[model samples]
Target chain A: MKKSSKKTGIALLLILAGVGVLILKGVSDTGVYYRTVSEVLIDSSLLEERGVRISGEVEGGTITYDQQELKLIFVVRDLEEVEKTMKVVYIGIKPDAFDADV
Target chain B: MVTLGNLSQSAAFMCSLLAMVLLLTGLMRNDLRFIEAGRRALTGVAVFASMAAFSLARLFMTDNFQVEYVASYSDRALPIFYKATSFWAGQKGSLLFWAWVLSIHVAMVAFNTRKETTRKNTPYIYLVLAAIVSFFFLLLITVSSPFEPLAYVPKDGNGLNPMLQNPGMIFHPPTLFLGYIGFTIPFAYAIASLISGKVDPDWLKKTRRWNILSWIFLTIGIILGGQWAYVELGWGGFWAWDPVENASFIPWLISTAFIHTSIIQERRNIMKVWNMSLIVLTFLTCIFGTYLVRSGILQSVHDFGATGLGGYFLVFMIVTAVGSIILIAESYGDLRTAHSLESLVSRESTFLFNNVILLAIAFSTFFGTIFPLISEVITGNKLTVGEPFFNMVNTPLFLLLLAITGLCPLISWRKASINNLKQNFMYPFGLASAGGGVMFGFGIREFYPLMAFTLSLFVSATIVLEFIGGARARKKLTGEPILLAFPKVIWKLRRRYGGYIVHFGVVLVVVGITGSTAFKLEKETTLQRGEVMNIGDYTLQYKDFNSFQDRNRTVYAATIGVVKDGKAMGDMFTERRYYINAKQPTTEVSVRMSLKEDLYLTMPMIGKNDEITIKAAVNPLLVWGWIGGTFMVVGGIMAIIPSRRRRLAV
Candidate 1:
């Protein structure tokens, strides 16, 4: 490569490297792993990971909302296996689409 | 009526297909007659497409329950405007709408390319447009036909989704579609340049207004969607980093990168290959974005159900990408840059860096959007990436982009000496430092927001300095009153100055985003009648809740009094509406917006005895986003206006 072209290449590589590092660091730092209730039921250690979003069917009649202090507790069962259930404790009000019958 | 619509659509499809064939054959045989016929066929396609579109809209207006699409998205009770917009609400209707808009664009291109200068390239350009229009019609007529008839006609159709009953539904979809379809014109021009081996800055200059026009539409559409979400969706926050949001945003990012780099190509006759790739990628990503929204491959709050259209969309995207890549490769020799970056301090380098940053952000967002699929394929687990991942990744990069927006104009072209850099950046840098110091004194010392605000002010400062410098120069040269020369200076150099205005507007938007996200406060409580709740120094007293019938729905509105610092700040109302045909109620959030903050309230739920739960929030500096959006649209208009060539005496 010509000297000038090589210099340009180095500059390009440096910027790309800097951006690559930023993206990788963010992925490791804030990327949330997701799990289904069945998987979590099999290995509870999944929840021990830094951040995990669990997918499940909210068991009917297991939702309780304390409107006074805005605490919510609910039981969600696996989509496929009803026996695999996880109780969740949340400290926020329900969003607009939080249907009680879900 | 359904038969007419179906026949018109079929005819439109045949016209586009015939246009493609004739245009290709005309090129091979060198027959102007055949190409002229092809161009006329394009006009025919537009006519038939419009007829079909009108037919479907007529079905909705007449409440024709015999049509499946109309039956699904409209009801007898919906208003006329909403019933009209229902033409593009569902998958079938949306595909038809895409074809309709695209056919109009094709017709515009065919009729407008009559000049001797443009005649040589019209055949290839028309062929590309015809091919694209044919693809949409292929999807529409075969898989997702709006003209499909129902087996049984019900008494009354299902109403439009209550969530879609807002004014946004009327405006957002069509505007976004215009943007999504507008990129095809530029893409077609690029393809024409490749096939004809006439790759130069000519196509770039010809399509500048088209690019800016489409970009403005996309910007407005996004801003309107955010407004809709904040007020109607009751999310309290404007953006959620959802898959559908990422779909539209990725193309915007790529197109933004193209808009910046194409200038370098135009002025310096370089980066031709990069500009080509960016435009082609932009158009393909528009298709990809539409696919993500329509295919339902990923779970999103949008809830566009999993259709069988994913494979077809995947095929289209791959086919276009491969075809464009082959053509670009064929013209690789012509696409070479005449010059390379002369120095790191050059404007060209800044454009390159800006492109890199933009593409990086787009790639990461695209990766995050399809992470579930990637994870499932790799690990047998559908791991969903969410808001935190996006925020962590994009925030710093966006801050970097903000910094570049300030730095790009400050640097001279090709190369700049240290003295020039010092002269240009000194004021912006000092202003940013002062901005940081002021915010720190106001106890606004949080890391991310502080950095964002400082960078935003820096960018704003550069733009302001450019304006002042230009106006002063004009004043000294003309020996006119400074006031008269200011506007004249802007008019003379409208394109550059207007771009600076847009940069200033972006700074406002960033400031708004940072302040609102960082300093947001929320409180929720169950309020009995005549009870009061306090959040963020504002006391909201619930006056009463009442229900009334409004047109097609029952509206439940809560009148609440707001008091701030011992002063009555008027009243705000939260509404919960139960559309008769909808399965659930929808919330109408009430917000009292000011320059400083937004006082937002939502009635999420009502229990027995009319005890209501109110979600209250104070989002600081939220109005700046909308105002900045206005400036962007206005500045974009100014930039796109054909600059008057009034010769400058200076």
Candidate 2:
């Protein structure tokens, strides 16, 4: 009984170790920095050569799209700090929920 | 004057509260009369909740703009079917629907267990279920009542969200809610067992069918939600790893673990503590998922706008968590297992590993879903973990799970000898390797796809081998034809074979997801009239543009002609709709589905220069996912059906 329990413990330890390694690798590989417009504006260098998603409200009537080139240029202002604004250039179809308020 | 809807809603809430009080008193005082009264009051709760739900449906059907819920989600121009389904399109109505379903389930449990033999655990079950039902009732009566009236009735109501007008929305929320509410039964039983100090396998046995039913509903609900996103959301793919999607998926992972671990408890009289904690965790995740979606703590397309009910949910979650831990800690001595693992390579060990992997996936998904909040609170930097994180983390884990699924049934219980493993695995292993080799020859060279295809093939071969070997043994023993013996074997071992069939279905689904994700081809182009764009053996030509009007929306449709390999296929028309009352524009994608692949088309925009921008994708093996989902549901149903063997054993 003791031998079998030891075996089980070793197996579990190995599995847990594998899981730990995978999780560490996964977190570093695909974690996206989420920033607000004001946060990004405060330190723009934080996003250098890294993928990030920023949450902000679109400035009304400041959105333009070039259908031929598939380019969308929009100005988004911080929800908490309305004075801070950023211009985003995206090249894809807009999401269905895209709006000035969102 | 109070409306019938208002009266019925209020009555349901009060009845649930009274029933909860009676049940709690009965459990505390060990009084059968109060327990009986509480059980009877549960019936009243069900009846009144149904009345409230029907009344809301009636309001929607009659286009009663006086009621806020009906007014917000329905308009005169909405179809009758959509109007009926709009019952769950908003927060208040969905909560009412959830409570109604929970009350009905509780009432059914009460009626089914009225026998004297099952009376011991009845009071605790009643207390747990009643407490849960009353929480929903509290929410209904206090913050988000569906029967709230508009101060002044408008002539017309704002229409339903245009994105929700599809057929998928009609079934998705209720199916998922059925799953979410269905877990309350097993959860109540688990807690009751702990509280009543009956930590035997009886509660597990009693709630087995309920557990399976909830699992099946959750599986179908998740698939249906993905299908809705794929077709209705105009995204080229399904399963974006969104927060709302993870909310549904997290409970599914925990429940899956619960189901498998409970099997160990039943078969070996082991892992009783593990089983109890898993059920508790499953129930907690379900409620936590609801809270996450409702509280808007995480931004998701599917969240109900932030409401006051978040505090109530948080308190309830904390109380339940603390209460469960205390009860379980006290009952730990009674919950000890008589049997332990005899070998590291045994069926029990396989199941344990499977549980670990499933829970690991759930943890990572839950963490990723809430990472932004965690980062914001801790480091003051919000960090979003996107699809890449989930796909990267989970794909290898799922592959491991599939390998275990292939290996578990072949391994003997308690201990498996090398000879036993060799005898079962040699042929399936060889066949899978050969299949992989053939695919490699066909130039399928990417690492993950190749691994996915190989693992899927391996699992499928294992299932087929199990069936064939069982049928052959049955034929030899019973002196019957192999084809006839197959059905007889399945009939005799329904639960075992039914699980094998579900695994087979999972194999198919994995294959479909792998093929669609890895081999999919997409092309986006702006084309003038009569101009052609070719992609993946199909040529699409911009034929014409047309416009039409319906009562609710103006639809601008673009007709595109399709020709594949010198043969002309039918014209596909995609629409850009402008809903009048909702003041929203929604894209209606056009898809031509076949056994091989789906040719999907969507028009993002129509330019002023008469150029149409079209996005076309060829998604391979997509239909197999739905087909496999059907197989899974059928297998689950077959497993739940009481076989003659079980009945005779009982």
Candidate 3:
């Protein structure tokens, strides 16, 4: 083998080792935190115990806020027409248009 | 507001149709008159498209609720400046804006090349470009017309998305579109060269500045988007590995690699095939990225609404990919590398390695992005490929890329001695070690951050060493001070020195990102009036709550007093405004910023009585990301300035 080929072989081995190590590390579930409301509704007990996130549109006339404590209470509707509302209690600052969506 | 509902749309459509028809006739008959007619039609298209866009903007600024786009994006309450910015805040308007930009760019290319000679096959190129333009213009008129009138125009319409109201929107879309559509010019040129059997280096030289212009715009656009996210998105971070964000970044990486590789071709007549392929791939990625973001193929905060154009884009991408490969294969003889690699340690080999790694990263990202769609298609399972997948695949590769960035500048063009390489790299290595030791002493023990901080230090050290070496050499030879000598060195070799500055800026950005991400602190608390919450070293006291009604919005605000080290700093008032007519709730984040960190607070929820809870984030060194981005923009501009010797480089 040529001298350059030997050097490239070494580099390739090192890169391959790195890739192997990374793959062996396995995939973490933290990357994708997406779940539809319908999916969560089917298995509420599975996720309700964990600090997981669920997203849906806020039901009209169901959102209440306390400016002093910076707490928001709302009901997120599963379907646009149906009144299947899930109560959401968040202790954080709300986006400006959150109330306007209602 | 100027009215352009039907007439201008028809004019745009007709002009594009006429251009395409003329191009086809010219290609078929090999007639110069038909080609000239095609060129004139392109100019007419430019005029009509610009008028349509300008009229749309005027309607937005004047608060013309009669226009559906304006009614949807702007309200009577918005200031004229923000109203103007709402031009690209939504789907229909942004697409129209994109079409307008493309028309202008295409027209400019046609007008500038009027005096040039084509190698008997330029009509084919014009035909391709004209056909592409017609597709967008027709799409604009048919599906997503910005000029369509609202059937039942209420007293007011829904306002622009509050997230897009920042100043970043004004510059981000234009700069990105400039970069995105600008590549089409060079891609068309490549196709023309391939068809005309002219495989000369002149095409590359001719499009050199155009390449740089697009690259620069892409850089600025990415930076602007990051800045907007950091300041506006209350997320306390810049890059979130969102699908839409990655789409823009992938093209940038490939284009940057191409930029570096093209230098060898221009200098030594090597890597001809690689340059051509890079241009084509970069253009395709740009188009694909636009489709990804605008087509709603992925669920992202940054993505727009779904449209029928998704399938159209998929078909178009397939056709372009297959057609380009066929063209390359047919011209296989001309596509070979003009020079062979002599040594693995040479600059050429390093560039090749960089290209391989960049392309790997691109492919990996592309796979991750489209995997969900593939999964849905194959298994009928809608799974999300999120931040975890990207961080797993891309982070390590980018870290290696950072190391390569340090090494590429030191390696000789053909070959270099080990001693010489060691001598060049020693100082930077020492600086990086010292930086890592400092970080370790400061209580940072995380593995990835530690490596990133060390690599960033190494990259910065290399850039500094490069500048000092060049300036010292010039100073010794020309009797100039280091400060005065630096600009002269830059002027002498704009690409070399300006690129080093850009690298330095990149180092700063990576450092800022690492610091903010790894060292960020956040907490959630519920506090009553006159009650205080402690997070990190700052004390936040809930002071007052106010509710009021304005002409357009109902405002609910929280007045929180921020105290650092038990000393009163300032009061930050966060608000949640409800636009009454549009029935949209928008958030306004309040922040206290310094050079070292930002105290970002957002009012996500307000209670019925007086209690409240705020999401406050302490993000460190985030401002430097914006500063670094600005530096990069400056460096790109400096690099493009025409020197005394190369007047046509611009």
Give the deviation of candidate 2 from the true structure as CA RMSD: 2.1
* lDDT, residue A33, model 2: 84
True contacts kept of each: 0.46, 0.71, 0.38
Model 3 chain A worst lDDT run, 10 consecutive residues = A24-33
| Candidate 2 residue runs with Cα over 4 Å from true position | A99-101, B24-29, B644-650
- DockQ values of all predictions: 0.54, 0.69, 0.32
Clashes of each: 0, 0, 32
Residue A67 of model 3 has an lDDT of 63
* Cα lDDT, model 2, residue A7: 88
- Over the true interface, candidate 1 deviates by an RMSD, in Å, of 2.0
Candidate 2: tens digits of C-alpha lDDT, residues B288-406: 88898788788788989797788899999999999999999999999987678888899999999999999989988898888888878988866677888899889988999999999
State the lDDT of candidate 1 residue by residue for B599-641, as single tens digits. Answer: 9999987877788999999999999999998888888888989
Over A5-86, each residue of candidate 2 has an lDDT whose tens digit, in order, gives: 7988888888778877877787787778877888788888877836778878999899898877888899999989999999
Q: Across residues B570-624, which tens digit of lDDT does each residue of candidate 3 receive?
A: 7999887776554456667787877898888876666656777678889888777
Candidates 2 and 3 compared: the better one by lDDT is 2
Which residue pairs show collisions in model 1?
A: none
